[model samples]
Target: MGGVSETHQMAPRPRRRRRPYRLAAALLVLLGLAGYYLVQNESTGGDGAPHCTVVAGGDAGGSYSMNLEQARYAATIAAVGTARKMPERAVTIAMATAMQESALRNLDHGDRDSLGLFQQRPSQGWGTPAQIMDPVYSAGIFYDRLKEDVPDYADLPLTVAAQKVQRSGFPDAYAKHEPDAALLAAAFTGRAPGALSCSGPLPQDTGDATRVKAELVKVFGSALAPKAGPPASRVAAQQAPADDSEVTLSVSGKDYQGPADQRRGWELANWTVAHAAELGVQRVSYGSKAWIAGKNKGRWIDKAPGKSGDGDPRNAGPDDVRIFVAPLNR
Candidate 1:
């Protein structure tokens, strides 16, 4: 009681604690920002999420990039041209046209009755909706019209040729896609060997040999028809005395001749690689190079034809384009 009156400190005011809700709110804001960046990165292909690119001029030329879906349809468009014996230039024209019209999407909806890769209108006599929807069919008619209607389309300006076929309100739009389309045409037409590559995740289901063969034949015509032989094996094939892969596309040694034949082989081989993911193709090989799905699916493996070493699968015969499919998931 003796002059200690000022000692009433009131328990130090119980040091104010930080609120838990405020900390949670701050953490949530940080998480949301991180998630947004991750999505943006994936969308821009910062990771390997099934993308393709074409390098036309080795290192000197400009390159183009496309998602897997665009690559598949683009390959089909190129195959249709080549299958009809259309020149590489013709394929370039057709691809550019499709890129401008539909961005290579097999859309079921479009301007009026327009549909499919070419946005061909069934009402305009392109084909039935179902037919137009088929990439092979749409591409086939596009080339036919380009050839029959404009027999000298190759010599014309790329835009002029495309506009004649498309009759689009935006006629000049196609010309912008020509440089990229040409890169696609060269790789897909097999004129520029090993110029295209696709990398990404594998499908959950396995590849079907029959489906693979059918698509090849449909796209490349009779040149890719399977030879008369034993039925496809339940097991995969190798470079042994007997080629036992699911499908064998003989680039016809007897008929497949000259530089064109090599180009043909490369064309079919490149196409198989392009459709590998969709068709569940496990491996595709021609000449000395082979592409295997999964981790090494990004690039072609160089191995001697009719030989397998270094744990690599056997490549197709120098004259053959072989495709091996994965066994069914069942």
Candidate 2:
């Protein structure tokens, strides 16, 4: 045994060759992490950057997605059309025009003195700078012009109708946005219920009933807004405690837009969700569906029907919409 040991130089225990395995394992782990993050960012905007999507409703349906700000302006444009009782066709025309002109950014600058969503120039008498900058005001006037100046606009080709109002040098450009605009119009107009949603870094401000009602009235008009209850009610607003966090919008659906229907309720609900990032709306419930802010993809989940017991907003009527905003104290 001593003689064998003397002769044996244990051939430098052939270096285990473990490093290659270790490197392979490390690469696999890194690849796994990268895949996970990409998936998260695409689905939920995991960085908390706000995002919104509207899916067209049908068997051959498609979708369009955008950041939070553009979605808000789109909602306002559609609301202006609805408040005017203009058909969905008119809304599509206006949306396409805005997309071509401003990409819906509500730009304060454009060609020459042009400004606002439609890039209406002050020199053109669209309005004063201040009024034209207002999204609701700008959109309202656009629809007014379309209705007054373009007879039978709804039946015209979208590009033709939009070109007539916008008078853009790139007249054909509006037609390209028609697919995206039509999808948006259908969703925002309430013809495609639960078709719109947002994912977010929720706003930090507290929800204000007054602020919400004022926004609604601005878009839907004071005379036609659904009757309010409790904190937001015209009568109770003066006396109700300042802490009320939710507003009950009684949707008789009788006064605004076309004939009373469930779509009107969805219209209000979708608009609320589209602006939830700015308005501090935490939840919006209409009929049997509810949307929660900052949730993954901000999907509309089904809830039970009732008169305000569960976390779900009261579904006492078919058309009522309840908006639960972030509480000031929270």
Candidate 3:
């Protein structure tokens, strides 16, 4: 006992165990890397916008795949174009309808002669087979009514507002499509409309901005120009068509269209013009009311109409827009 006390055993210097700091740090780094990879590959199954192909038979009376393909393209164009034209809310609703009506696929066949992306019935005054087949026109027509009926559509329920325009037999059908449409809208609008596309096969073909714009001109008219720098040549609209007009546009899709039909006509016209460069449009006409006669005669004007609301005489009807275009110089 006395010896032990004297020895005062240096208390087994508690086997000083080294801290595992480096190991811990390494593990944390590995976890962080794994998380990042998981998120990035979340949507694409590790292959973004994969080139998956499906057989969609024909525009109508074709394979289910073919029918769906049409709708997908229609949805893509509408979502992207509307995002460019109106607000996100409108795009959301439009996408929702396409999702339900055709699974975001343009089906030439629908209940009792209905056709096109919206399943619009030619017999009911939508348009002809060819016209309805044109996605841009169909979308434009849908937008016309949408802007008219949807007072504050951006905030309205997607299904509710869409039903107002579509008057579908089954109003509730649109509800089920909200999820998928949201996804497509997000991807097309560049807002992450959805975390991913449908689990099914991805469309092998998707049009580009240039292609879409060209189709826009084909379906609508040569009333739009691409968003390019100054035009290589421009012909004074006044000097051309007697009915030719002018319109001042803004980023908000606000503009002056003059009279009743004039407003609608011009709105569409201006939209075409705005999309001219993108659509490879060569010439266009904005109603005379839109022309300042002096101020930046050819330059775009945004302050004239639709700025103050219904009071502005130049403002077009909620559904009216009559505008057209020609080659820049011709």
Candidate 4:
């Protein structure tokens, strides 16, 4: 009877399971807040924003601001156009098309299957998805098609020429972007020397001559080389001049010539300007104009005649594009 009097053990209480759910909800809220902060910072010129300036025709043409990504894409489009010998109008059309199609953002998806900067559709024979996704490749293809389909695309209205290539539902939309596109093209194509500049935190690994040369080759083709000095000899020297922070890119006459050579030189010069932040470029000088990254906040400054290179007297020729890479830690 005593043994049978043992009380039955009460069942253990169930543990509360709400803490994990609450923690997860809190985490989601934090993440959402972080995302909101990033968006706000981008829109409000925060440290994370890629501050960029595009001046249409040097100082007199005025300037506009675009995000770093847009500047890079615009530079690429201009490079492609220049390489193809396409006129400024061609670059304008291409840029405007990209602006309308993707707002200058290279997207992985688009209306139905469009892709890349121009949103060329794989289903429509633009190229494979992979090819279309490459900014350089897509740009080349766009220029090629424009040249083929509209031989006189340079003379046609921006919207009409772009529509010929794009065939978009809202063909008229491209016109609105023409003015901005022209500004971008002018800057990137080098018509406006020292007109394009970008400011931001430099990359951890910045100002490598090898890397700069490689990028030049990648964008402008392997045929790219210095126009005057021995390419390897000068680059291999790697000795900073009196400035203590300059790299001279003397383009070869064989590579650039004729009236177009001036534009080509500027194209390279402007490309350096666009990539200043990433490459630690402090100054880009071509012909009589120079863009100083720190001086006047990266505006193009006129160099007094015979002021370049300690009275070397030979005017800064059309083929010369001098890039002064910022010293490390500056």
Find the candidate with the highest lDDT and give its number: 2
lDDT of 2 by residue, 253-275 (tens): 33433345577778788888888
Weakest lDDT window of 10 consecutive positions for candidate 1: 229-238
Candidate 4 lDDT trough over 10 residues, lowest sum: 229-238
On TM-score, the stronger of 3 and 4 is 4
Give candidate 1 misplaced runs (Cα > 4 Å).
1-47, 226-245, 304-313, 327-330
Residue-level lDDT of model 4, residues 116-161, one tens digit each, is 9999999999999999999999999999999999998877888999
Q: What is the lDDT of residue 120 in candidate 1?
A: 90
lDDT of 1: 0.75
Model 2: ten consecutive residues of lowest lDDT: 230-239
TM-scores for all predictions: 0.79, 0.79, 0.43, 0.71
TM-score of 2: 0.79
- Candidate 4 collision pairs: 226-251, 226-252, 227-250, 227-251, 227-252, 228-251
Q: What is the number of backbone collisions in each predicted candidate, taken in the order shown? A: 0, 0, 39, 6
For model 1, state the Cα shift of residue 297 in Å: 6.5
The order by descending TM-score is 2, 1, 4, 3
Residue pairs with colliding backbones in model 2 are: none
Clashes counted in candidate 4 amount to: 6
- Candidate 3 per-residue C-alpha lDDT over 1-330 given as tens digits, one digit per residue, 9 for 90 to 100: 446674566655575555688788898999998886665344223532212212222342211211324434633454345434666567668777876786555677989988877888888777898888777767767777789877777777888899999989899888876655554444344343111122112112221333534444454343334344433111122234443432222211223222423433433343343333333333232333331111221223344444522122344334323223322223
